[model samples]
Target: MDDIGEYIAKESIRYAELIVSKLFSAADILETYPRRGTIVPQFMDESIRQLMVDNYRIVYQLAAGDKVNILTVHHGKRLISNTRHFKKKK
Candidate 1:
């Protein structure tokens, strides 16, 4: 198995922090390593994964070569709506 790594965007970290309120320690996030896209896509490399932590949907993507990247974290209902802006940037 490849060694998976984490790459959290600054904004995503901020958003996650706000919702989870430091409840997710560095170790917690690290423990989620090798996280795959269970909902939106299969495996982290194919697409982003939205993990539910209470009312929040933690959006993240995994890159090739075993790397986990966090996109954003928001309320589940607003996830799809809020992600529209990111598309425009691409």
Candidate 2:
């Protein structure tokens, strides 16, 4: 939005709010269906899955005791493999 200039600052804020609201709604679904999300194509790990919300990918890991840890929320246009959140530990 910064690059898009201040003309649409209000629009940007609204979009952000909408995205966040949808994220929470998706999380609520995970409470009952943890495996609802598909395995992340970047890793193919069953424990790590992702949900798509608008233009973002909601990456998450199924933790112990039925808890879902949100790993990241990244733009769909970018490459996620390079992100530290999914990097291989050295």
Candidate 3:
């Protein structure tokens, strides 16, 4: 949880200064619980949409060791395409 927070904090100041600061108060909360349920899932295995800051969608997956794998952060307008390969920068 600490690692996830740290990574997000460093990744974008906009996300940190504007979003996360007012949101996700502590990563420990996530650790204390098992798994939080999600909504708007088109498929059972592909992905799930979590509401945050009223507009953000946090796309994540759970691993074997209770690890929360954050895959992507996207806005409401452009829904995440249901695809396995997200294009990477060259």
Candidate 4:
């Protein structure tokens, strides 16, 4: 998330801050509405969902006890590959 903000800051600090703030706000909403986001098509798992904020995709996992774990924040156009944080359900 900070990486994105820094990248955007190269152009304008205000724009970067605004984008980061919006990203945080969108993620916070999931605390109250765990299933507020749609299923991530790439994973096909109900627990894993994504929220679109500005041009970024905030990917997260719905854990036990209503906990939402943010997995990553990346450009919308980028593809999410398998990593230590997650494996695509096949």
Backbone clashes in each candidate structure, one number apiece?
0, 0, 0, 0
Instruction: Identify the leading candidate in terms of lDDT.
Output: 4
Across residues 1-90, which tens digit of lDDT does each residue of candidate 3 receive? Answer: 344345667887566565654346422344554255364355455334244444555555554577655556555466667677332213
Maximum-TM-score candidate: 4
For candidate 1, write residues 50-89 as lDDT tens digits. Answer: 6666555666665576565666655556636434533423
* TM-score-based ranking: 4, 2, 3, 1
lDDT of each: 0.48, 0.75, 0.51, 0.90
Give the per-residue lDDT of model 4 (tens digit) for 8-81.
99999999999999998998899899899989998898988999997899999988899988999999999998
Could you give candidate 2's per-residue lDDT for residues 1-90 as a string of tens digits?
A: 232223334568676666777777887889889999999887887888998877767788888888888887666687776467665444
Instruction: For each candidate, give its TM-score against the true structure.
Output: 0.49, 0.74, 0.53, 0.92
Candidate 1 C-alpha error for residue 22, in Å: 6.1
User: Residue 69, candidate 1: how far off, in angstroms?
Assistant: 1.4
RMSD of 1: 10.2
Q: Which sections of candidate 4 miss by over 4 Å?
A: 88-90
